[model samples]
Target: MSTRIEVVAGRRRWTVEQKLAILRDAFGPEGSVGDACKRHAIGSGSIYTWRRQAMSGELGGARPAPLPSFAEVELSAPVPGLPTAGSHIEIELPSGVKLTVDSGVDADALARVVAVLTR
Candidate 1:
């Protein structure tokens, strides 16, 4: 008979590459998120968040894209003489904050924007 012992201390940190691999398996045709989560000993929420970050280009990889960043937004009232035309939509947050954005806003960008606004 053989006996082995292992000791673990501190929180586990996952590297970008590891995260990417886990995400690939979680989302791959032959793998499921539940399976990946169990196999990697991580929560589904973490995997989903990593996937979201990966999509927004926060985690660098072969597919390059813009990183999520916050910019100084200047909110001004519409001039009385000017016409509010073209394509624009109003989004009212749960906190009762209204935002006017272009109709063609990117989905990922909009999601990040909404996350910030909600916070």
Candidate 2:
């Protein structure tokens, strides 16, 4: 006999949208019932119940907006004396901190600085 194990987070209540998402993932492409159960920390029983409910029209389901799997990015070698002072990037943090950096700023270094600030 397998005992169901659940991974609980800070929030216990799951919204209808979340439940539908779990159901979709449980049976969508790359569907593996056991793997889905383990990944979501939910039980196979619950998945089946949701499936039945959906099929019987007991549950109202909506097709979520499809998300793009990947985006095209262009990377080019940096040019000298480029990205003049006038070209800048600005980001506002939740705590009202305004961060401004030049376009030529190193992405990895800027990411590290942002990570430290967010923490």
Candidate 3:
């Protein structure tokens, strides 16, 4: 003789952002869907569902943008010693070489600014 058991669970819907966030965290370095589910107290099936939804564009219209390539940026310059927008300033190093940089700027802008300042 054998006994049969039945289980019933309700389906809980999550927002698209919420689902994507979970999927991103779930697949982090050294992490898997199973591990993520275990760590976050979610079901493995939920992760699979989210993955499928993301692939099919069923969740939302949102998608990650492709990263820009180096060729996309231009590197022309006024040279490093020049100034712009008051945000950047020029400084002469101990070696008597001038450098220009913004108070807080990104690498691309910093490089351009430095080129202008050094020129």
Candidate 4:
């Protein structure tokens, strides 16, 4: 008696649509790169390659939009007698983008400003 062994050859090909869908899910809330890779049975390297292809317009897929990032703001009790109105927070992004928000600015309005600036 002999045991039979079969070998599979060739890499799995992913469609453009499938790549886009997986990327979208990965960027969605509660989604992560590791989780997406495990769920899709794909490799992290493949995901990066797909992302590069998408960015370079070689994938014929929609380019991933830059997601808005928000930072938590905590207003510590004004130092001694510092006027709150004159107090503003300055945020410097990794891209060297700077944002200054007044202490009394509306939260919603500030978020909108940040969303636009980051994009």
In order, what is each prediction's RMSD in angstroms?
9.3, 15.3, 12.8, 11.9
User: 35-75 in candidate 2: lDDT tens per residue?
Assistant: 88898888898889878777545566554333223234454
Q: CA shift at 3, candidate 4, in angstroms? A: 8.4
67, model 1: CA deviation in Å?
A: 10
Between the candidate structures 3 and 4, which one is better when assessed by lDDT? Answer: 4
Better of 2 and 3 by TM-score: 2
After superposition, the stretches of candidate 3 with alpha carbons farther than 4 Å from their true spots are 1-11, 61-119
Q: Candidate 1, after superposition: displacement of residue 70 in Å?
A: 18
On TM-score, the stronger of 3 and 4 is: 4
TM-score of 2: 0.39
User: TM-score order of candidates, best first?
Assistant: 1, 4, 2, 3
Model 4 misplaced stretches (Cα beyond 4 Å) = 1-6, 61-119
Cα displacement (Å) at residue 84, model 2: 85
Winner by TM-score? 1
TM value for model 4: 0.44
Candidate 4 weakest lDDT stretch, 10 residues: 61-70
Candidates' TM-scores? 0.45, 0.39, 0.38, 0.44
Better candidate number, 1 or 4, judged by lDDT:
1
Which candidate model has the greater lDDT, 1 or 2? 1
Lowest summed lDDT window (length 10), candidate 3: 64-73
Off by over 4 Å in 1: 1-8, 61-119
lDDT of 2 at 1: 94
Steric clashes per prediction: 0, 0, 11, 0
* Clashing residue pairs for model 4: none
